[model samples]
Target: MATQGRSTLDRRRFLGLSAAGAAALGLGMAGSAAAQTPSGASRMPPSIAALGPVLGKAVPIADDEYRARLAKAQRLLAEQGMDAVFIGAGTTLRYFVDLNWWGSERTAGVLLTRSGDPIYITPEFERSRAMEQVRFGSEIRTWQENQSPFDLIARTLRDRGIATGTLGIEEQLPFFMADGIGKAAPQLHLVSATPVTAGCRAVKSEAEIALLQIANDATLACYHAVWQALQPGMTQQDVQALVAQAYGRMGVRGFVDINVGKYTAQPHGSIEPQKIVEGTVVILDDGCQVHGYTSDITRTFVLGKASDKMKRVFSIVQQAQIAAREAARTGGMMGDIDAAARKVIADGGYGPGYKYFTHRLGHGIGMDMHEWYYAVGDSRQPILSNMTLSDEPGIYIPGEFGVRLEECMVTTPAGGRWFTPQSPSIELPFG
Candidate 1:
């Protein structure tokens, strides 16, 4: 049986730990806006306790739209010469079925063939719950605890006239489960279905883009609230709790990494106690979900005032982010954006590329925070219309500090436009 908190599990899957990750995150907070506990290094974030939720619109993808996604995936499967793709209880299944299921020890998901409708697989006990959420497909198949679902899967494939053919398994599907399926059905060859799932998901549809934009906007608002509420004595946990509360107040759920002072240099950051004092640099990277679509953005700035060097590095990061955004053009190569962004960081004297400017320029962001066809150095993938990506570029000077400015942008008929405005300057990051 799927737990009632299935939605929270989905969010946790998207957001790895940071407070936002494990400890700092408080773990159980959903829209509840739980208070901080055990006061390790700090008290809770400043009050937004008086505020109410700011949620606006929320409607899941329509039935016909999910069908369209299936159509696209089918086309990709044919191109890849695969007979069917087995998606097991994750985002890919959610994307196609509009159902949120927790992957468990039992085999549960859908076996989507190259043509016709999809077959949803689940334990006999979960059939009712899974059935209620099914949007695109009607065929439901179930197996008992003693039976191997893998055998059922083989039977289904063979029933669909796929006795001996290729099966594209979801890349994230547990290898043990895939192995079980392969062992049960030796005649079927299994391959990575990334070309099917990521191929369909990498590019956002109009509805997906709208939800993504809303999610990003809400995340920005929460970050803005955190910045305004920040005080010098505040601990990193304090700010983290504040962001969580603010997200609840705004009727959105998100995860944020509040890196203070030198802690910002480590990128994803440390769990050590951090207090925001005068001239302390902070990096806030976070995102929230709108109807299951995701939004991610990062902004870096100084607390009271920035030193000249801090400002310089911040500017360079801001410039690198902008260069990456502007470099995105339809029909162009994906690698170009990363190169353009890296050039700005290198030219700004933070170069010796990949040394100080660690990590890729950006990544595809939509459903998954870091999706496929990333904007790493020299990727040969061509830019496509309505494809969404993050233009995040940073300079991390190990012992000093790090500055990363990120904005989620979508490829359009023209070029690319950010879901939210890029931080203009260190002095006025929100501007």
Candidate 2:
């Protein structure tokens, strides 16, 4: 998939991927036959050990793409009648400028005007560091200690001939920063930048879809490999170790939460110790990233064999997932998609609304796992082509077990399409 790739060191710094963390997850080098106890390497089955890196075709987003994104945002700002948008030091910042800055007490961000170049803001001490990753713009205004960065922002705006109109603030900006800006520039009206930011981000470009595809494919492969290596008596932690090892073998950092038996009834699972046994359900949830795009998949199955009830629930959930996908047509209301899926689950004896299906059908997936817009009952947001989202429908029955089948999908004129094929059955999840 076409994604923006970073060096392993950079990815580690950004994602906080550590050898110790990996080792804790039971990750080890591939093709090593020597069994070492006390480490997860000893438990690493031959199926997982034989896997190799699949990131050879992964590509990084080019500087031109970042510039294009800025251009689109600028157009949106003009159309929305906003003079400029203040983007904070997080995913929105990274999305537009390719800068992976960590937010702190200090103020740092970008002020993009509708008519001119993007202006970056940062601490004077971190000017050089900011420059290294500021891929879209050249003008960076810095602030010194004991000085108000908010004042600097006001000054920058006035200098750009934007002294008195509405200013859109990135939705994720800290409250203190927003309040500070309001006090410093009482002449400016602040509003949410969702119209501009989400307008640009909600839909995926071909390159981004490719990246998401690779990410989802990698996660599915990891699940398949780990499923083959499962054994009785393995704890949830042991399975997590195997998942980590599988991703490590594929040369990507990933994560998963495991639930065994009745614990699978919990949507997010529990930290309470769980062990696999015959005829019990097990749930593996979460996924990995390729470049910056992410994949979120959940697979529920059994180590030995599923009971008749388990099979029935699985079939209903799977059908609901498919119904949601088929209803996700471009120009259709987002709520309609959720309704279609909920109807399937309800008819199958699950819910009237969020009773057995406890949460929304799915959420938008992109650079962040959960982004703007969602597939839920109350949303009236219009589905658009190239928009990527999750088609996850789950039925949770407390004190027993639960079934959830999730697959990230993309919207098209023909409806929704999955990045990877859906789980064929509980016993053949990867298929």
Candidate 3:
């Protein structure tokens, strides 16, 4: 599907987001979720052997796109007055060059110079493997096990006539590596390269938005199916297994963080065993990925008919999420979105700040879940078009229950639009 249109969005908006088509909701989460023992499931599941591939539709990013990212990083380096930027072997390197190398005690990195092509730094023993994955770099500077990679990096910099200017290092670079580089070449000044790395990654391209849309749609589909399949006494792990099976059926991979009963108050997860009980709150918080892009969504509702108090609190949280979404504007201050959400909660008799909403309003999501441009009370970053972030606002009452409603959204000229529509209500949570 074409990723952009003006009148189509206007028509959808007028028709009501709830009435909009089902392409927006997909993908979800698991793994680091709450501890749960496998239990008697609520439904039958297909054998793992029978499940089809989850990544069948995903396409690796194009080579030309990776090259464009390098060019953008180089431009940012020049603007920031840096001679070069060292991209460590994690997300930033993957963001710029599509290489999925792991970071370790051994220093493997990508050196992107402002004046020339990118360089790959590899352990001598892994040079051939590095070439197999290397997309943008032609020069590979290899360091043997007995040799000091730090010294090699310094000498390489000096060789490139970048002996004294500031070198921008990605923020995730290990301290030992940075310290070694500093000691090896005390003449070079090291600074955080967040501006370059985040600058390039903060905004999503059209293709990225398409992939994210698919991811969110697939996961939300899993959520809808699993919620209907839920039975009254299923354990949290049972619910998780069902969600996984739904993902397998939907042809996407995902996870579900299900907190039943009183454990719903814990945000990240609960270690205590829990099960569905009458009128107890259930929170399903999670997301999924498509072609390395991700979607983060959280939906909370009661397993049975909600209490009047539960319904009231859910309405407040839902309004808070809506406030956050409506407040996002291209070029507007990022803090405005959080402030708007907080205002609704505070006005609805739930706040005094973090007393109710204990966490920041949201986080940027892409190759990583929590990335650049956080939605907090004091952030001053401007919202740019195609920048996607979670719009989750909640009220956590320690001894009682918590209510959180999150949806992934992208900034457009017309304001923020969700990858999935906000939940319909406390009674119809998945809608």
Candidate 4:
């Protein structure tokens, strides 16, 4: 059975040692202790305590950076002969302002034009919070609950001299919004502007990478804490609650949609009501989101004693993960990187059906948990340096068990670097 507080004690000791060791190495204590620890910890990680101060000292994106980004967008619009880029949706809003907002209401949106500063059309209730954080170079237009935000958006476009030309729309725009915009402004042309946004977010600056590193470190702490707390009789939901509680205590927000899965059920099935039985293969696919950045991790564990089949499956998946990691070079073919692991499983006689894995090998992770860049089923895009992605491949035997292993990796010239160091062992119910 997994021991509660075992890894938490280790984490506390590790942070203490890290601080002392850093001083011994002629380097000052760096990063937040809390941010450094993962989601499920009894004690705050050293990084969380230290990160705020360190990050404060660290260089932030200058005002010029945002201006430059806006300028680039403008250049793209000019090249396409468009007057404005109609950006809507969560990801696009965050990309432009780096501000976080709730998706509860329809009042949150922005209409960016080449001629004026970005126009923010937010709900009456959230306008206060939006104005406090969101930076709009020009005028901000607010829409009340009674008024349609899109209607105001169209009216603003007309008043600001933006009509009769191409309007760039985010790929994730709601169908309703698309229709409304078309009806409101019939002469306007809207095209998918995903490529433009992707180009801006694909390349991570040093500051962005540091934030990600901090988030990853914190998530690892949470993962270790949850594993330490796991018990044989606990249900998957219990473990999930425990993990979330651990994260909450440490002042870290868990992923918006966490995947706390059990390998005991049929493939892709929901967690059953029964407690996690001994010999069950359990996997916790969760992450901690910090400062709008996310860390995705998955660990497969056995409840009590590991069976021979469990060991074999874990070994195969672990080795396949290694192969996939090795193939992801800075300039290598993405298809090759994906094939490395799939080939391993296919050669192991599991075939590509149940053992083949259901989802793609991995996807880019940053602002969004699942971004556009992919490793599998995408043959053309090559791996680029500084791109962070998850490597998840698994085999699921229906009505028996589900086994999946996932870890985040950042692309580099040599290959990929694990955001968080791989756990020492995959054996569950660590004894």
Q: RMSD to native for every prediction?
A: 4.8, 4.4, 8.9, 9.4
Instruction: Please report, as a residue range, the 10-residue window in candidate 4 with the lowest summed lDDT.
Output: 1-10
Model 1: clashing residue pairs?
Answer: 17-21, 17-22, 18-21, 19-24, 19-25
Candidate 1 lDDT at 124 equals 93
Kindly indicate the candidate among 1 and 2 with the higher TM-score: 2
lDDT of 2 by residue, 1-431 (tens): 11122111123222223322545444444223443222344556767777888789888787888888999999999899999999988888888988899988899999999876789999999999988877666899999997999999999999999889999999989899999999999999999999999999998888889889999998898888888888888876566667766877788877676778887887876657788887899888777878888888889998667889999999999899999999999989899899999999999999888889988888888888788678888789999999998899999999999998899899998889999898988877876
Local accuracy of candidate 3 as per-residue lDDT tens digits, 234-284? 776566666655655555555566777667776764667677776888887
Return the top candidate by lDDT: 2
Candidate 4: segments with Cα more than 4 A from true spot: 1-65, 78-82, 104-108, 123-130, 142-151, 158-161, 255-269, 353-355, 428-431
lDDT by residue for model 1 over 1-431, one digit each (tens)? 00111232133233233333334355335235454422432333444554456445766788888889999999999999999999998777888877789887888988888899999888999989988888776898999998999999999888999999899999878889999999999988889998889889888888998888888888888777677777788776666667766676677667776677777888777767777887878888868778877777888877678899999998888888878888887888889999998998889998877988888877787777767667878799999988998888888988888888889899865667999998887767787
Name every residue pair that clashes in candidate 2: 3-59, 4-60, 4-61, 5-60
Q: Cα miss at 223, model 4 (Å)?
A: 1.8
The TM-score of candidate 3 is 0.88
- For candidate 1, the TM-score is 0.89
- Local error of candidate 2 at residue 175 (angstroms): 0.4
Candidate 1 versus truth, CA RMSD in Å, comes to 4.8
